[model samples]
Target chain A: MKTRYHIRPRHNIRPQSCIYALLASISVAVFSLPNAAHAAGTLAGTDIQNVASATFDTAAGPVTIQSNTVTIKVDELLDVTVSSTDPGDVITSPGQTSNVQRFRVSNTGNGDEAFALTATVANGGDDFDPSLQQIVIDANGNGVFDAGVDVVYTAGVNEPVIAPDQNITVFVITSTPAGVVDTNRANVSIVAAAVTGTGAPGTSFANAGQGGGNAVVGPTGAQSSASGFLAVQATSVTLNKTATILDPFGGNRPVPGAIVTYSLVATVAGTGLLNNLVITDPIPVGSQYQPASLTLEATALTDAADADAGNFNGTRISVAAGNVPAGQTRTVTFKVLIP
Target chain B: MKLIIRIMMAFATLTGASLAVAATPLQLSSDVFVERTIEGVDGTKTVVLEKPKMVTPGDSLVFVVKYKNVSATTATNFVVTNPLPPAVAFNGTSDGQEIVSIDGGKNWGFLGDLRVAKEDGATRAAQRSDVTHIKWNLNQPLTAGAEGKLIFRGVVK
Candidate 1:
């Protein structure tokens, strides 16, 4: 039997197999697509270049990190400029004197960042009122002074956002009172956010921000009130002899015609007021009293209120007998002619 | 097998729809902190300029306070209350300034107008010392990382 079996064509297609292949392919595609997108969009670590850093030189040197991340860099420079102009072009006048000071702040940063600016009246004597002063912000970052751009003034508070490489102006004015001294100074500081990098130029890798610059007010009137409390203080008091003849022979060698001068000094302390006060130093029993010629000399005397007891004029007084009010304890410099 | 393929396609489509619905990006970092510092004084606590280290009688002092927004979302309906310490007097302007009695932690308005009967059957109006606290109402919202400061003055003893 020559059996030539009829070769039937095998239908190899299976619905389940097709489905499994399709599902596996779809999963692979979905996972791979995201990986590719992330690789394309994500910034590489090397792309960020920390340029420079700035440090805040405060009364206390470098400040410790208050937070984990530092906010200021040392490489960055902040320019704080101030200018004042009296409305009438004359700073001194009798009428309503309005002086406007313009403060310009600019940041030289490589990236777009926000900065905090703080303006303070530095060591302003009792005369200046920080509360009365006005502070305006030009939100547009323009250097010009414009109406309606006035920002509310708050002492010791940081101003609004300052964009990088941009400038902002702050105006300060004072109304001078009659016969009052109009002197004031302002300090402006820019607190830059911290950047990255070590040993880099201005790279403040530490996230702690830093401050810079001091601005001062221009010319004004004098202080009006003399009622300010005065405290006199002194570092130290010292006594010195201008001329001392050293006796090489050792004994109390009283050389003939040799004159000895005794001087007593009362130093004024910086903390208190030494008003028309009198000072007297008693002569020791061993020292002889020279009544003929008694002289008083003072290094500094601002007013004519000081007067010697006996003499109407403040110069010198003659010592007659019992403790002289003017010459009792004062520094007595006399020429005691040796016998 | 065909059913399995169909199920896989459906799952992918569902995931796609969900992703589309939830595709909001993280706009800000978590570390931003907006802060404000205010300078002011409470009653009884006399802060002197010369000897700021100690509080004394008949002394003028300054009070400083700081406010910060630490939340990820904006903070709204903010209120701060500070009480006048005993033996302290408020300076010139008191507008927008309130007095409180609840130890400076709670808010109170004028206490002089309100009278409460005591156990002795006597009615007494609140005095300055009875002020529970002072409050500042900021109706505006504070955005994330925003800060502010406030200041005031007071005289002691």
Candidate 2:
């Protein structure tokens, strides 16, 4: 956008004096122009700042117009985090460290960043420590720790630069002590700090402002710590079956076709929270589980599989007992017809 | 058929535009952060919530809106509309009444001014549940290098 001014070239009026006033007024006019519409401008959040330059071929000379240069700067927010799905917190058996618990560290920052990785034991709970700790990156992104496939993550220097919103899956490999019991528990944690803008691994920042302008202890949200418990525990669900025979002549006898009621008592005994408890009981070879005779704790349930919470398919009865706490029992009773 | 196809293309373009309009960059992102002061037998200690996966009743949390001048130029006419989470209710004007929006962003006033219609065909005082959304009129320009949080305390419903 260019603005041309005609000066009439008055002999009495000084060219310097007139041009200064004219340029000042033009600057004000350009700035004071009614701001962008609510939908087009701030309301809709579509606004960009840029310095402008104007030149006027007047009696003076081709002069360049200058204003404050608005340098666009965005906040470099770093948010590194680690989360694990150790739902049951099951303990590792002796000579059995194969139970791999996966922990993910993500760089939820605006720019690419390298984070300092560290794993430590947090003391607070009745937990045991892993005899040996190993950290491995999920090479194939399959969330599984394949010994030969996935490579071990070396500490310090050469740490991978995780992009914003990108995360890498990590396996908290642990080995139990020689003597392991059911009552033993262990806790392990992983921490990651931003190494971006910092020269080396041990570089630390003080009074650093995060993305939201909040002064955090670390460099930014760039640092996070997550601890997972590896407890020694197991859940046991007991099922007891019972049957009652009814004959065609109203007599209790096993004939060609008769109804036999079966009762299954499911009990859970464990130290941790058990989840996704799906109980399945297959029908005997001589009889079939009746569809409509299913009752859970005296509550009638649909016979078809997936018909209700408790489903009895053609060959078996399957029920989803979700989140069965420790020392609790669930009873499911249904009838089967002897064919 | 040609006319119908042209109209359909126009409709699709307009729909896409309307959806994109809501996610403009200058828009402020808001989230809930819960913190409580636990009164223990020893003393009182304030614990900052980290990844709040579960919350109990009677617990109060801070609802903050992070505003930034995402655009190259200064962002004027800044106003943030933060909805109270379904499980939480507005406690009061937390920042000394400097930020008050008890009425679905219609008018800025005190809690007493906010009202709701009752079953008796009469207008009555609005309850905590009636606080559908909270609005803050920044009355300031968000220039570059400007980032801040507008916060209010909310109690679990």
Best by lDDT: 2
DockQ of 1: 0.01
For the second chain, the TM-scores of the candidates in order are 0.46, 0.66
Error of 2 at A22 (Å): 43
lDDT by residue (B22-75, candidate 2, tens digit) is 543343444555575566788967577543332333446665555554445565
Work out the TM-score per prediction: 0.22, 0.35
Question: Backbone collision count in every prediction?
Answer: 66, 7
User: iRMS value of model 2?
Assistant: 22.9
lDDT of 1: 0.33
Docking class of 2: incorrect
Worst 10 residues of 2 chain A by lDDT: A39-48
lDDT of 1 by residue, B45-107 (tens): 432344232222233544444465554556454444333332333332135354344323332
User: Model 1, A318: alpha-carbon shift in Å?
Assistant: 60
TM-score of chain A of 1: 0.28
The A-chain TM-scores of all the candidates are 0.28, 0.45
Error of 1 at B76 (Å): 70
